[model samples]
Target: MNKILVVDNNPVIRKMLSSALEKEKYQVECAEDGLSAFDCLDRFVPDIIFLDLIMPNINGEQFCQMISGRKGLEHTKIVVISGVAVEAGGECEMKGVHASIAKGPQFVSHVIDIARKFTCDHFHHAGIYQVFGAENLFPREISKELLAANRHLKVVLNNMSEGIVELAVDHRIIFANPAAAQLAGMAQEKLLASDFAQFFSGNDQIRVIDLLKQNKIMAQQITDNDPVMFNHQQVAINFLPVHDRENSTVVVIIKDISKTKIAEERLRETKEYLHSIFNSVQAGIIVIDVETNIIIDANLRALELYGIAKPDMLTHDCRDLLCPRPEERSCPVLQEGKTTHLTTQTVKKRNGQTMHILKTATVCMINNRQYIIESFLDITEQKKLENKLHSLSITDELTGLLNRRGFMMMAKKQLRIADRNPGKLFLLFADVDNLKWVNDTYGHDIGDMLLVKVAKLLASFRRSDIIARLGGDEFAVLLSDSSPTGGEEKISARFESLLYEENEKKDLGFPIEVSFGVVAYDNYKPCEIDELIVKADKLMYSSKKSKKI
Candidate 1:
């Protein structure tokens, strides 16, 4: 099995890498830092080293330097894992490392590729070793096998797209491919036997001649984006040592990356500009994965609106801030399968205060992943203002009773219930006995007080009864279901007693008196609410006329 070593200061990261590699059936080892890793290397030489750039006792650069001149560790390739950007640079070359991969969503995949590349390289060499078995093969057969392998390698090296050149210990170009000669702006035969350092300048900060002076067996990479070469092309180069125990030679691979480098620079600039605009907008913005609802990105305004710290908001489920039922609440943005959706919701904050928010979510895709771009604004104050206006429109401010419009709306709902079930329904229409006379004698304030008192009296009945101030000196009530024993008569008797007691006290500016007319109906005998009101009005006038007699 291929051995893989993970060196990171974080235990979680170390365990995560180890578990993933182990699951792949590779022998994996974990170390806290460079010191622990050094101890690991003494016993077991891994095919690949997963090294973190930043660690406690010794950092990645120091560890690379220490391991570079080591005799037995020559074939081990260092795959750097760093929190910072690991774009193409000369740093990897100086450290003589194979590749640098930044910590990101795709880091594990990069590690797998590195492991596969080196494993295959070693596998090829092992195949050759087995073919020329020391115990079984004759000397003549071994020499023939070696020559055949050399001829095959020569053909493959010449066909490669990347420029390849073999350099001697004195930094002389001993061999050059057609691609290397073209990069150097020279003929392949002319490029041979020339100093390799002649093609590069000091502005790049890397000198192959100086690097070769170390005479280390490990391969080193040297990359330069400076447009100082032939036709001003950027270059990425790697010098790997190949030797036969006593004599050493270096193989260099070069690739031109001018176009790719330029494209990435422009892309980065565009991203930064877009990020500035994202945060500057007034609304709170959040981008979350569609399936998981895991918050991927959140802006400054989002932080302020939710009263949350940045770190907590990024990982928390988007629904936890609004709909408490997380899994039950699928992405509202995608509910109707629309690309965009507008909605309003009430969300509770860390402070336990609820806020009404107007939200707009647009379905978006980034790097082949589905996401919802949600933008919202707190509308709590606006909602409060709307509720106040609605209340004034449907409620009597003086007595806090439902106004005519409010009563009609509610009466319809109650009527529907009464019509659906086998229940007795009663409508009571009442008029203040002499409200106009009281207003004329003692002013309208006392008249208002009497209206309020009458409203309370009407409200004191069954809780299911609906009370409303229909208009001036007019009130109505809808009673559902019959009382088991004491019916409306019981309610009327108590109201009379309360009125007489109030009249006796003389606390009000005028004595309390009200005239009532009742109309009854059952589900079997259905009638329109308007017809019931007209019948009750006629009964009230008849009662009033009888009193006059």
Candidate 2:
């Protein structure tokens, strides 16, 4: 007989496990605690140990560790029984326990099967353990094949692309595959005895359970993008119910469609990006499909111009939705078949509100489908004060270079590219010398002109580089493909020589002197682009000190 030891502090649990194991014809032994279990081990060498984690002396984890290190008991399988979280049971496995079973009366048959699997020939005469009286339901010869099939089915279920879970009719989990456990953020053994409602939040639990009771597959989109918070993370769940005619068990497959949700989000962002650009222009933008000549997409300005209250009604064919025109009124842009930057007259708005609107349309393809992009700039209020103010915020009033905010935005983009390529990036800090002398001698207007001239010179040098004026007499440049030893120094020296030449040629009451310093990126060390600027600033101050000396 294959000797099996059942250890638990609870007498009822120990007796139930012993009865289950004896029914499978295994030689069963019982112990109330770990010390008694060790004594049982000394007398009878058991093939498998069923250990209860919470016991009086030397709990299951410690006992398993001790027994696993024994010289001849290396092959003896240790199965841990626990009412705690399954992660604790997994810790026991890492310490050399072979399997873990949840402690419950309903889990008795499962524990027996686990024992029989490890114990070789001891339980062959006894019939396989079955729950819900499934033994007499199938023929004896087919029973073995059915058990084998179920084993294979479990392997397939565990490896499935989608998550699979089986629940008793009352909603207690009976089986859960690894993917299902991972999706639910729980362990399989712990989930087996848990209620399905426990996995969902308050309102979600009620919503999901009600849906499951209807026995219909249900899908809903979740929109939380944060990975840490459950509600903040988005996922689409599809629930399917499984029925076993003989056992009356219901299995539900839960699939996590986070990828699909991400795709939908990207699509929405693209639409919003297009809308932002469209609203920024004084023109109204409209998109139409070429194949069906249907109005597929339009911006808010376009809807306002057309005087349409419901935009969805315009999604139909353009000819059916718009006012009828002669056959000769075909768009000239389409006739050209190339990018047409010409102005054309059109009666696009409602009949009563018809006006001479400048329309431009171009053909483009998105996602392998063809469409026409039409833009209509009203240009009615060209001299608006608010529009000019918006432009001034992004543009420098003195030097016409991008303002500090705009420069910061563009520099962030270049930094991202540098991070991806893992290459040398250089930041140059420049400060104009004798700026106070210029203001004292030549007046503030000439000082401003000198700054503007320097900005123009720097802008003409490298259009690709990001240039920004950090307040009066201070300017910064970001250079790509430059390093400390050769490429960076060469560029820095070229700029220095250019500044010296300009200063030597022009004399506007004060010298046009500038000090500069450069810092190259260290690929091995990860640092923010602003850190490079700080280093460059310190080096520039060092250069200014040397010039004074």
At residue 448, what lDDT does model 2 achieve? Answer: 90
TM-score of 2: 0.40
Residue-by-residue lDDT tens digits, candidate 1, 1-549: 999999998888888788878877789988877656876888889878989876654457657766776777777777777654233133434455666666666667667655776777853353221110112222355544654675588689778888888776667666677788788888665665567777876754355565666545577766664333433667777778888744467888888776777887899899989889888888999988877878989988888888999899887787776553566677556777988888898888778899899988899888999998889999999999999999889898888989999888888788778888766787888888888899999899989988998898888866778899999999998886456654556655766776677688777845787887887765677777788888888877887777778
Model 2: runs farther than 4 Å from truth? 1-148, 208-247, 276-280, 306-331, 344-354, 379-549
Candidate 2 per-residue C-alpha lDDT over 1-549 given as tens digits, one digit per residue, 9 for 90 to 100 = 788889998899888889888988989999987656765777888878888876653456546644656666866767777764232323445466666665444568768777756665444344432222122232344534554675588689879966666665566666677887787777655555457767777667676678667653433322334211123333444445554433344556565656666787899999899768877676777778877777877767777777765456456666544423535446445667786545644454554655456667778889999888878766434534546876677668888777777677777788777777856777888898888888888899898988987886677658788888877888888877644358667878788777777777775645677888988766577677678778999999998999999
Per-model TM against the reference = 0.54, 0.40
- How many clashes (backbone atoms < 3 Å, residues ≥3 apart in a chain or on different chains) does model 1 have? 1
Model 2 Cα shift for residue 529 (angstroms): 71
Give the number of the best model, judged by lDDT: 1
